[model samples]
Target: MAANENKEYSHKFDECPTCDGDLQYQNEADAECLNCGEVFYHEIRANRHLLWDYDELGWMRGVVSRA
Candidate 1:
């Protein structure tokens, strides 16, 4: 089997397709383009477990919570 055969395949758009701007993670299932203000949504699998939260100071905190 290929090295990536067991890994779950997910596509991430690192840059904006229209303007080539930097992309920021808006949430677990969405990302936004910094320069062009474009938001992109992705489908997250139910078995793929990941969670993120924000503190009072607006810093991102990543947690692995599976349900």
Candidate 2:
């Protein structure tokens, strides 16, 4: 019996390699962009689920307070 430790998988997303624009999720864990016609590949290393989901107002307030 062998213990497996490899869990991380490489993830590829259709992202713009020039401007780093928002990569839209296509369907099969892949993304494509029609803006700049750029392609990219990524890997899933760490996944951090957001707990405190905030809106624009909350984010702005947070920035102002920090400043």
Candidate 3:
């Protein structure tokens, strides 16, 4: 994958706090408001860089199947 491309898909939500519009989740915990351009952090950690990078953490999710 390229520097910009990520193996895992980051979640996105639309919800604006200032304008009560839409907020998009930039990463696991950070969200940005589409209308007001506000940023919200759900889970605050001491080391932010370490938490967001999945490759650094070596997190792997198993596949799911529907019967």
Write out the backbone clash pairs for model 1: none
In lDDT terms, which candidate is top?
Answer: 1
Candidate 3: count the clashes: 7
Global lDDT of each model?
0.53, 0.34, 0.42
| Per-prediction TM-score | 0.46, 0.30, 0.40
What is candidate 3's TM-score against the reference? 0.40
RMSD of every candidate to native, in Å, equals 8.9, 12.7, 12.6
Tens digit of per-residue lDDT, candidate 1, span 1-67 = 3555334324455666547788687654666779977555444356453333334565554432322
Q: Return the clash pairs for model 3, or none.
A: 13-23, 13-25, 14-22, 14-23, 15-22, 15-23, 16-22
Q: Which of candidates 1 and 2 reaches a greater TM-score?
A: 1
Error of 2 at 43 (Å): 2.1
Q: In angstroms, how far off is 63's CA in candidate 2?
A: 29
User: Which of the predicted structures, 1 or 3, would earn the higher lDDT when compared with the native?
Assistant: 1
Candidate 2 residue-wise lDDT, 1-67, digit = tens: 1232122222333335445565665443334456754333332324521111123453311110100
